[model samples]
Target: MAPKFGTSGLRGLVTELTADLITDYTRAFLEACPTGGTVHVGWDLRPSSPAISEMVIAAIRAAGIAAVREGALPTPALALSAMEAGHAAIMVTGSHIPADRNGLKFYVPGGEITKEDEREILMRLGQDWEIALRPGALTEGTQSAENYIARYVSGFGTDALAGMRIGIYEHSSVARDILIATVQQLGAQPVPLARSDTFIPVDTEAVDPATRTRLATWCAEHALDALISTDGDADRPMVTDGTGQIVPGDVLGALTAQALGAQILCTPISSNTMIDAMPEFARIERTKIGSPFVIAAMESALLADPQAKVVGFEPNGGFLLGFTAQGPAGPIAPLATRDCLLPILAPLTAAARAGISLSELVERLPARFTAADRLAEIPTDRSAALIEALASDPAQCAGFFDTLGKAEEMDRTDGLRLRFASGEIVHLRPSGNAPECRCYAEADSPERARALVEIHLGKLRDRLG
Candidate 1:
């Protein structure tokens, strides 16, 4: 099977990405959107990424373009450097997906390649374009990691986090070492733990129970101010409370916006509802799930108010800052791509400035709680059919939620989000990155929100199975 485009880029099973396919896909991306003489290529910690990187570099060189390889780094790091150079870049990562899968994210100096851009790449590749597939040697550079760490250090300075203690969960994340280094440069004492080589698919959105227990335990054991982590590619963040529980990503976004005194915010509909109900934002826009949609929405908002400070985030805790904010050390320039560092630092800085703890800072928000989980191995098409049926007619999903209440209102913005008569809510959608059905719910109490997600996800598994 041919690899297909996902919300961020192209992805599929590792077995599906043959050497020839990788070369051709890379060629298609370059041929579709010509760029500078040099193309920056990076990869994640996945075992498949290295091989794919060589194939991509070979393709880049085959096109008579210079290929600058940066062994393995976070997607944001590579993208930011590429943006600065005004050259195109590509990242080989499966993101949070299982190690058996992998993908390539292409960036055109401006940022991530859009849905339409993928279409053009696919069209060019489908034109019977000939490709000679072979591996090639290239000097690996350290610019991606160096610049990424510098971005935080240069903007935040050396001691805003002086008194805080952080536990960095280095779970095979591409940015593991860099995250720890960045934390230390801020003068925070960082406890590095559980660094692994095997890929671990840590979904910051639908956090697993083991991770939940471990973070809280780490805080108590080490007296940590928080535990910081990220997805495989380090775009999505996973930040915790002083008590060890991770704060939801959307909540992190709101906290960041409030701390930065941001004027405009763009988020996916699946984000915490409190974001929509919050009074802090002057302009707020909601789009379908994915970074492309959020970035596009941020663009429209920026156009309407050029001077407005803008930021975008997803439920998975990926933060995208559109303009310079009053960063701790100096003026932080715009990094209009998914970032993990900003989300972690912004909220911590806000809490520090306000004389509060991480949990306390989030607890001050508008009393709304959100929880999400997923049904694994469900076909995307099957999930789509189920979503279409349930969204159009609540009766299709009513039996599963019988204990709660009737579907009072339905929102099909990006998925099937059903508001219950009892004031609880559930949003069901196919995972944009993998073969899974995702469910997110919100309620007045944290327990109820999580329970709703658990029950709904359980029901989905049974039905889909």
Candidate 2:
């Protein structure tokens, strides 16, 4: 596999993600599992995922473990099911990667496997590559997909979404069904737009402007309240309000926490400049820019204060915790994974409670223009060199200006972030999961943000070239 363990798990082109590799990885994971624990296997809508799911089931069964197959569900659904069953999960999904690639994300009883854990699994599998003999049953299990959908629907009582209209862009996401079902169950009119049989890869951070214009046109015609879409696996969310403007993930994440009256909020630093705007809400903590990091902090937040309510991460936008405290839904537990359904439902609930449209809720927040772009095929060493070059000589960095009569500060939390004097910031971070260097910038004006990003990228490209 090509760099199996990135920020999440093993992912590669479908051809490179062979059946043998999956079987072996599943076997290795099962071996590492706590004894006698059930293994939940699930997959997304990619054409090759079902076959990979089957391979995992065979491997898990061969290891003498019970297999609860959650066919064609979101990655978070599978994880939640596994956690509910008090077992582990293996999700076969490429997430937001192009249709050409596919992979597996494994979650254990505690959380996702760390880089060290993956290395051990890979080493163990390498030692026993030739031990492929027994085949196991692929028996179908009871449909637990409904129960998964019900969690979101039931959490937000029907009265909250009784009169809203949500437009779902069902572009090859496993959460399409749950998104529609939850809206319907909550008495909202769900209009599914752009339902595709073939995969439509949506880069959450890089939502195209053409798509946004198209959605706006549809909302105007249909008078829809909001537009929502999930990543390939339904773990990440993309939401747009009535104006057809795609709301930044961090803004939606914060609103979700606000709706729940959460005491504690955990998120990454790639969020909007407005996250610090919520001073009235409970404590807010920041983690490294990844779901696993957010999840790890969430675990500690919950542990330290039993009453602490934790919301999940938003790669593009954040996810809300449906059940933080012990509720009738059997202690609505904190999921260590992202669920797109929460962003859609929680904001709708909040909007309903406020008697306003999604656009209004977003308008009430501070104004900031956030944009992200990526330069593919960038080498890791080159990216490091660029950061090092900038850090070593900040005064020599051209095209970056000082404004607002203040000084600039540079932060290297997960990546290199330069905060300008004008509150405008630029970020250059190598994607841990891909061979690309992503550039993000946020400013008071859209043109300013775009211009700042372009200037920095132009300089970096020349250096890398």
Top TM-score prediction, candidate number: 1
Tell me, by lDDT, which candidate is best: 1
What digit string (tens of lDDT, one per residue) describes model 2 on residues 1-465?
Answer: 273666667787788877787877777776655523677788989898898888888778776667877789888787777777677888998887787788888888755665556666766775454443544334454656777777765666666588778898888988888888878888889999888999887777777668878989988888888888888988888888887888777777877777666767778777776767767556677777777677767777778876666676554764747346332223345666777777677776778778888878877777887777777667777887777676667564442333323337877887877786678888888777766677888898767877776776676677676
TM-score of each: 0.96, 0.90
Error at 450, model 1, angstroms? 0.5
Report the lDDT of model 1 for residue 60. 84
| Candidate 1: residue 390 lDDT (0-100) | 75
Over the stretch 1-465, how does candidate 1's per-residue lDDT look in tens digits? 146776778888899988778877888898888566668999999999999998888888877777889888998999888888888899999898899999888888788877778788878775455543542335566677888888888887888788889999999999889988988999899999899978999888878888799888888999999999999999999999889888999999999888777878899988888876778787788889999899888888789878778999899999898888888788778888899998999889878877888888888888899999898888888999988887666576677678777888888898798888877889999987788899999999999999999888888887799
